[model samples]
Target chain A: MTFTGLVGRVFMLPLRLIINTCVRLRIHPNTLTFIGVLINIAAAWALALGKFVTAGLIMVVANIFDFIDGKVAVELGEVSQFGGFWDSVIDRFSDLSLFIGLIYLYSQLGRTDYVMITALAMMFAIMTSYTRARAESIIKKCKVGFMERPERIVLFMIGAFTNRMAAVMWVILVLSVFTVADRIILTYRELRDARQVAA
Target chain B: MKRAASLPARVLWNAFYWTYERATWQYDLMVIAILAFVWLTPPDWLNDPMASGCGPLGWVLAQLR
Candidate 1:
């Protein structure tokens, strides 16, 4: 198996039991997704208070909810287009809340520069998702990016655990910008090629 | 997957396998850049010096000392 697949499997191993329990409990997948967002919001609150370890731990639970929701949906045969869309929408909120916490913390510290940097990172990160979602509407699939949501979440956990969030922001900012641009170019190429094929 | 493989050999093989599986120069470059920033960048540059003296790893080192 590939490295990422191996890492993903390892990460999911512990979550598998939780997922099975949720499924057996017959919990609604959307309820799980909603609960995940609430937990993530609490994590953002911890982050804003500069409690890195607490925030990190809370995020781990939030992500477990995130993982379980999808698996439960699949296992319970509750999968639907709206479920996917709702999950994605909640993800955007979850993603932005973390950055907002950082921004608030930096703003309180009067570190306008870090606030700006954090904001830019947030913008680019969302744009990476936006570009793929927009591109996939045109192309069959547009996964031509390296800085996807999973990578961002992993980086967030690493930064929180190590207290190296500044460096993590830089990495996210650079890679996310590249990913957005990559998607744009790939979409353009695919659309142009499709046009040529039609002609 | 070979159980008889030496540790260093397994590490080297995994490195090769990872690069091959990544399938994009940009992915490799991004990984390298992150590693470089982690290794080479000054803590002061990021402006979070509170963690510099006793971040998680530093605290562990302090405990050891």
Candidate 2:
């Protein structure tokens, strides 16, 4: 296995325990997804207050639920289209809340430039994920992007912790916009090749 | 399935697969580390421009100036 795969699995160990407990308690995965949103709401509030450290820490814990819900759903054989849809919807909300908090913070500081940057970053981030999902509907898979969720979340948290907000937002915006373009091109090729073969 | 990809395409495809499936997460953690390092180390020249340059980052910092 790749080292990252090993690390990822190790990271998931504690989560597996929680998933077990969740199964024992008959807790629904959808409920867990909703709880994740609530935790992120707190993180957003922290961000708006410029409590970067608190928001960073809160985000770390909150996002764990993202992994746990999916694993629990799969382990319990409860995976469903609705469950996936709900997870994606909640994730977008979480993404938006972070940007909105930043926008509010910048507004208060009267940094109109940062406000626009945050808004642009947020829009491109959503588009990056959207392109992948829309492409997946028409192709086998659409993981052809550099700014996937893990990167975006990790970079944002690092930016928060280090107080390099501008650098992080710029990186996210550039990479996410590039990712959206990459998905479009990848999807086009896949569809085109499929058509050529069918003819 | 269509015929196998040509050798160059195969090599490129494998490289992309390795990046997406295997190396990207580890690389992401490394990037986080690197960004932190850049912020912490703060060579004077880099910091100066970063604090008041023309880009989005500089513009944000300029608000505080």
Candidate 3:
């Protein structure tokens, strides 16, 4: 087995247990998804309120829900186009809420500089996801980027736990911009290749 | 959109399909770095007095006082 696969399985053990319990409860995946977003909003609220440790802990719980929702859906045989769409849309709102919290916190601290930096980070983060989604609509898959949602979430948790949010913002801004560019380039290259093949 | 596959097949496919693929050793190293940073970083570094102390509501209260 691959090294990452082994690590992934070890990490997923607890999550699998949770997924099983949720499955036995016969809970709807959409409900789980809804609950996840609500928890994320609470995490954002905590972040805005300067409860950094509490926010980090809450975000861990929130991401557990995010990670398992699709698994629960598949287990329940409840995967649908709408389920996918709902998950994607709710994710955007969740991402926006976290950035809003950071922006609000910075503004409250009278740090206009960090507020602008956080806003730019947020914009690039959204663009990272948007570019992939838009490119995927044309291409079969547009998973060319290195800084995907999982990486971003991990970085957020790290920032919150370490109180290194300023550093985290800069990292997110740079990596997300690169990710956005990577996706656009991938789409362009793929389209050009397709046209050549057709010609 | 189409439910052509059986439940088991669908589950198996979804398992691989949805999970993010971290193909390289660098990805694993990155994960390790994150875990290390979270656990090992000193509290003093990047410590923001304003952020860690008074929240928005507290700031507002201070303003009124």
| Candidate 1 Cα RMSD (Å) | 7.7
lDDT of 2 at A37: 87
Query: Which residue pairs in candidate 1 collide?
Result: none
Candidate 2 ranges beyond 4 A from true positions: A1-7, B1-19, B24-65
Kindly report which residue stretches of model 3 are placed more than 4 angstroms away from their true locations once superposed.
Answer: A1-6, B1-20, B30-65
Which candidate leads in DockQ?
2
Ten residues in sequence with the least summed lDDT for candidate 2 chain A: A1-10
- Quality of candidate 1's docking, in CAPRI categories? incorrect
Each prediction's Cα lDDT score? 0.80, 0.77, 0.79
State residue A34's C-alpha deviation in candidate 1, in Å. 0.7
True contacts kept of each: 0.13, 0.10, 0.13
Model 2, A154-193: lDDT tens digits are 7778777866666777777876777777788788989999
Worst 10 contiguous positions by lDDT, candidate 1 chain A: A1-10
TM-score of chain B of each: 0.36, 0.29, 0.34
Q: What is candidate 3's DockQ?
A: 0.09
lDDT tens string, model 3, A50-117? 78788899999999988898999999999999999999998888888999998899889898888888
The DockQ values of the predictions, listed in order, are 0.13, 0.15, 0.09
Clashing pairs in 3: none
- Least well predicted 10-residue stretch by lDDT in candidate 3 chain A: A162-171
